[model samples]
Target: MKNYQRYTKMFSMPPVRSMDWAEKTCVEKAPVWCSVDLRDGNQALIEPMSLGQKVEFFKLLLKIGFKEIEVGFPAASETEYEFLRTLIENDLIPDDVTVQVLTQAREHIIRKTFEAIKGAKNAIVHVYNSTSVAQREQVFKKSREEILKIAVDGAKLLKKLADEAGENYRFEYSPESFTGTEPEYALEVCNAVLDVWQPTKDRKAIINIPATVENAMPHVFAQQVEYISKNLKFRGNVVLSLHPHNDRGCGVAASEMGLLAGADRVEGTLFGNGERTGNADIVTVAMNLFSQGVDPELDFSFMPEICEKYREFTQMEISPRQPYAGALVFAAFSGSHQDAIAKGMQWRRDKKCEFWTVPYLPIDPADVGREYQTDVIRINSQSGKGGVGFILQENFGVNLPPKFKEAMGYAAKDVSDKTHKELKPDEVYRVFLERFVENRPLFDVSECHFKQLAGGIEATVTVAEQGKKSVVQAVGNGRLDAVSNALKKHFGAAYTLTTYEQHSLGEQSTSKALSFVGVEGDGKTGWGAGIDEDIIQSSFEALCAALNNLFVSRGKD
Candidate 1:
């Protein structure tokens, strides 16, 4: 935090105010996405992916709906050269997908790059040179005229090579580190290159402006993009692109702003894997648009599978909190959050809502290949009654009464707290079964029979306790009340039947009926559940279970 005077902003704004981009609230459509995973993402790895791995990654990019993918700098090494040759020789490149290869703005490299893409149906020979004040003064030590000549010579060679090779190839030029260059100078260099290419409506040129090192706020980058977009020659025939790096952790923001500034395409890596901090995360950016009702054109429905494969290929661990794609992105572990999410989900289902407006979740997890039971309402010590109840009803078809859910939640939380782990859905169900459902330690009801009376029901109950059984009879207003009275009389018990509810567990005539019962005694409450084919029998059993729990709470078990 000390000696901050050593650092100054590396980004320079275009002289004109270009807040017009700010007028646009959101990106209206998907940009032409180019995956640089094979080139930019691969080079930054501690061990770059092998030829086989690169092939798999390339196929993945194709599957993800990318039409333009930067394969690699084929002229840089034998591996790179062989990879391109393999794709070309094996006819791996699809007819619709255009494979791009990067080259430095040098003649020999340009010549070798053309050889790599020689008989391709479609390709983009991307050429770039560093054009920043620091890069020129420190790395290149070349004047602006010399830097401009490098780009111009490269453009001329590409044009000459395309003529000699007799291949219809698209051209792409990048003013690498364009953010640190003066906007006017960068434009000057790009327009000069465009002049050599002489792009037209039929064969357009691409001018990619890369934030090689982010050194200013995102607004500055947007302003620079707007300036280039407005002043570039052959503007209607050019595809303006943005390649933002995340040195300032603003790559996605900068890319969004750049799109709003009239850039047509985006060049980034999945999960933002690239040099330094990384490229703008194309997944996050695309999903952001997808959430906003724009089709990102990329299929991420199998996000978990994508995450698994990405880890396998790149050997990079995605943080659990990574936006949209991480393991715990949709997980609601806090008690209040879980409660709100549970109610919101119920409200959606009750209202038959067509849009996803769940509380605390920007997008539905199910929309991205995640389940509601496990992915959304995860159970931990910090979990709440609503989440616990949601897990039961959604996963196991056991819907507890609202009051019983609180008790069940407490029991599950205690287990999780002591064990220092999260409780899964089945584990929560098991806790419910052991604590409330069919729970009888002091006594068990072997059978029950209800008989109609004048204005009430008479119940005959057979009770078993410590290997002994007894039959008792009593009368009440309802069958369950009659059974409760019979049991209390036989055991000398004293408790009020405060609540009872019942419902069918499944949608069939023979489906089991689930019953919940609650008893209050000595300022303490006890809850229980029962499931049986007959509602009457289930309620009788529930009454017995509730009595047993009441006995336990009174320290009689």
Candidate 2:
């Protein structure tokens, strides 16, 4: 294998032998999506999906409205043969569905692949052999002329076998690495195979051309499609299919470009999970059409469910951030991102599902299996009010007043400055309620609490010394300053009230209020809060909460 790092596919497999140029126009039409999830996907699995897994996956494809699903290479194993038998005996194959199997042109494997397809209401026997010069010279050890005879010989055998078994089987042919094959010879060989099968309109043969190794760019793929679409004598008797891998990480783009070039069908696996790098990501390609207002016609509402089952069956990891179908694909962690998404969601809803245009969003989360809600309440110092408010609304269903939000924003800043990380949702709630909304704390502090030592005057403050107690009373501009000035008096000149404010707290006129105080004790900003039915009492309580906040900031456990 060539260093795939330097090339697209894993190996220097072959160069596409040039084909005779032809002029053909692309005919726009509805696309047929053929899922190769079972075979192509299975090859990439660390532990191949079991027979049960194949059966389950096959059924999922059928249930999702796939009329043609390539079940497996039945001739490859006893287990695969049994799975095909189970699909047949259980009457699971939909009448309109055509069960397909992969096999080489070798008589026995083709016969065996067909044997597994027997008794199906409708079936397709897809036979292929590598025909490129590289295959002939290196892999197959034969000339192109000899490989053509082998392929055509295989087709003849398949035709007789299908007639003998009394099964209605359609023939599909591919030159394994079709893109690398000489175009004139490839068509010559495909035409030779078609002559043996003699396809009628009702049983049109599917000529599946694979960009098997992504040796060329997309426009080249277009030219190849146009080449065959023009030269084929019986266009009505041909179903043009394209199977492109993601070795170049451009499978979806290549597939779309192929469709534009007149491909009638596409073959791919979900999440692009297949052999080396992966197959074309049908989910992304189809959903890309969805975003463009074209009906992808495939319902991916159960996309995550499909992904989960495939991961379990195939034992392949799907990146959490993979496009459209990953766990974190719709998750927003940045504050700006969350804000934009929230606003976009609102605008989309308000436009009556019409006038929505937003940044950083291609499709709505709800279009796939995603929810706009999250447990992400942690807003840090770097966060904005929008993020903090969102967390509060999600976690506590709390509608914060504008001022309260401002206070909590500072609190979050204080915490984040220490931790240097976003505060978790629970932490945000704890800090908000601990300092601002709640009027009372659960316990008494050593330095600050209501006491008889201060005479008839009541007050609260924070003290940091272990087992230390000191009380002082002082007159100040107001009740808040009086209490704060008392803390400075006790803690010495190092501690003092910097600023304080009180506001009416409750719904009724007779209802009391709450207080906020800022102290620069020890030369750092310490803001406190409290609310109660009594304005003065509320002020004292808030001053104590601020003091307690200082204690908390000192790493109190």
Candidate 3:
């Protein structure tokens, strides 16, 4: 903070009032996604990937629907040169898929780069030179004309070599560090390179604009991109591209805005893996379009598998909270969030809605191979009744009554709080069984027999309490009421049956019945659940369990 005066804005705004891109709201379609993972991401890694890993990553890129991939700077290292040769010698490059290689605007590097892709069916020989004012003044220490000549001479060499080799190789040029360069000057250099290539509709040339350091905001970059798009020569045949880094954490935003500004392609790495902060995340950029009802043209349906393989090959860890792909991105732990999500899911089931309009979720987790039970509504001390009930209903076919769900939620949360850990679904189920289903510390029912009467039922019940058993009889309007009366008489218990509900656990006729009961006694409500092959038996057990809970609440145990 004290040295803030030492820093100044290095980015230059475009010279014209090019604000047409601001009228667009979102990226309407997918861009030509060219992955630089092997070249940009691999170089950023602490340990660069082996030749085998690079090959596997290339295959992965092909599977993910990339038409253009920058393999590496083949002129930079023996490893890079050998990797390109391997792809060509083994015929690994597909006809439809174009492999791109990078080179500086120098004759030797440009020649070596062309040699590396000799046998490839389709390849883009990408050439770049720094055109930023900082690079000219501090790094290259050259004049503007000298830099323009560098790009033009390299373009001429590319054209000459392709004619001699009789290969229809496409050409791409990048004004490196374009963010720091004057927008008009960068356009001048790109147009000069385009003049040398003289690209046609059949073989369009690429003019890439890179935010090498990301010194400005996304709107500034979008304006600059618009200026270049409108003023560039061979405008119809040029494939306008953007390559953005994440130093300012706006790589994805800048890429999106640049596309809206008429850029046709994006060069990035998966998961934003690159030097410094990393490159723009192609996954995030693509998924952003996918979430907006645009087809991203890439298959991320098995995101977990992709994340695992990416980590294994790169030896990098994916954050648990990474967007769309992290472990916890879809996990809802807050009580309110879980409750809302539970209701939203029920609404979908009831209405059979075709659209994804669920609250608190921009996209359906299931759309990305994640599930509701395990991924959406997770249980913790902060979980609520609806979430607890949802877990039971989804996983175990036990739909708790609304009032009982509150009690169940408290019970599960208490366990999780005491243990200082999140409760798994099975652990929550076990808690339910221990507290509400098999809970009989003071009393148990051995058997019951009923006899019909005029307008009521008479029940003879065998009650076991503190190692003692007794038979008590009472009359009531129904079997459960009759049993309740008998128990109150035998134990002198005071309680009212506040709630009773039952449902079949399965669709089959012989499936077990599940019953829930709630008893209000001593100004408090206690709940219980029971399951049996017979509905009557399950109801009876439910009543007994509820009364037992009441007794414990009243300190009669």
Candidate 4:
């Protein structure tokens, strides 16, 4: 029976073809960073992280590199207000990093939010109010004229408070849900706020136009931002920002499109952790820049650590497949993907990349923190010769003969069909070892005698090599060592163990340990792998397979 089209789908990842977003978006250095962990992100979290969790999450974000962090709305709660005051009283505020406090246009909360950041070295009072037609009718119950007054009066009050503080205070304001708001009305409210704030060229007013619910496609988001940036007043002293959520899972794409349109800053959480579907994945967005040969301006490689810290603070699980920061983003699972990755890595080793062209990889894992080279192997009905070939190439440094690759693949299929499942690690290893190394039937009941004698364990291992030679043995630290030493005597020291590494071959403690070791003899290096419940026996046989590689390499030489 022919297999279904499973492996056919992985060949079309976006990184394989795109290359222009980086050059256009990140050219301006030192862009403003507005973090939404408190307001936008926290609101989306399922549990709405506790006060302690919120404070810890904020501290980690501030520590990572964000200069402007939106600490929660003090007017919303006594608890939140106390948290903001705690930041100021503890003097955690730095000279370069501005403490940002958010509030609505309502006078009481707005003033209270300002009071929360009163004694900071540098600060930003980010006041926001809903301006979309739906929000105005449903939430604020205000018309365009009424919303304009709310925005203008709030900006004037914020400007006055910053002036009174006599410190380096910056002002930023967003017309909430601006993506759906009429362009003319949104621009009017934004320009009025900019006029009231009277920002200088040195400290441009940040105009954040949020696709609050992410109702628009990426192109539409870009168009909306472009429209506003062109129409907004104080173009010289204006920073266009976008805070698009991932209600539709296109947060990263939308953010990229917005940046291309005219956004100077994009606010998002690390793994797009936020309300609903989460915010735009800043991780993907930033790494896209790195992949395109442009500096992303921010050092986001602290990704895993940062995400782990996020997990600790928010008590949330970071999905294993999250982009750039996920556990498995850099890992390959299919045979074709693994082969491509292996070749790409080899090409990159030369270190003189003309433009970072490699298959199945947009950014190197090393640039982040992933270091393990793995292509998750599986025994599905659709898997091909490439899978076994990769194991030979990657685990043993052996490129199988064309006939060997196809024959082994059929062997795997036969075993899989019999077992009604994919071949387990031990099963896979045994097939190859018997053919080329141990020279014995993997399941043959060979007699093994072990005795703690002399300086170490003495082992005599005897078996019938399925089609080639009789079982031999070797000796070492323990039973396996003795068996290996005994085998070497007869095998003429074909290969010796340079290093032995054992890890769970798959997701089972009951699963056999898979062993890989380096071998050197006759002036060359080769690797071999074996899997078995008996770890020592597995290593012994695997080393024998590696040694046999000497014969193949010698012929090639």
Residue-level lDDT of model 4, residues 1-557, one tens digit each, is 36665423111112122323434744344345677777767776667777777777777876667877777777888877787787788876666777677888888887787777777777767888888888889887988999999999999888777677676578889898776687778888999999888889878788887777777567666666777777778887888888888876889888877777777888887778787788877667777877777776667766767878888776678888777777767655455775565566557777767666667667766677665434244443455566666555555444554444555666566666677775644566566665544542222325567777667877766644444446554556866557667766755555555666666555667867666655567777655556678887677666655554544556631
Q: How accurate is candidate 1 locally (lDDT)?
A: 0.92
All predictions: root-mean-square deviation over Cα?
A: 1.4, 7.2, 1.3, 11.6
Total clashing residue pairs per candidate? 0, 2, 0, 18
Q: Tens digit of lDDT per residue, candidate 1, span 1-557?
A: 77898888777778788789999999999999999999999999998998999999888888888999999999999999999999999999999999999999998999999989987899999999999999999999999999999999999999999998888799999999898999999999999999999999999999999999988888899999999999999999999999999999999999999999999999999999999899999999999999999999999988998888888889988999999999999999988898899899999989999999999999989888998988999999999898998899999788788898898889899989999999999999898888887688898988887789898999888889899998999999988888888977987878898989998988889899999999998887888888889888888778777878888989875
The C-alpha stretches of model 2 lying farther than 4 A from their native spots are 1-30, 349-352, 375-384, 401-428, 438-557
Q: Ten consecutive residues with minimal summed lDDT in candidate 4?
A: 9-18
The predicted structure with the larger TM-score, 2 or 4, is: 2
Model 3: number of clashes? Answer: 0
TM-score of each: 0.97, 0.74, 0.98, 0.70
- C-alpha lDDT values of all predictions: 0.92, 0.72, 0.92, 0.69
TM-score of 2: 0.74
Q: 2 or 4: which has the higher lDDT? A: 2
Q: What is candidate 4's TM-score against the reference?
A: 0.70
lDDT of 3 by residue, 231-260 (tens): 999999999999999999999999999999
Ranking by lDDT: 3, 1, 2, 4
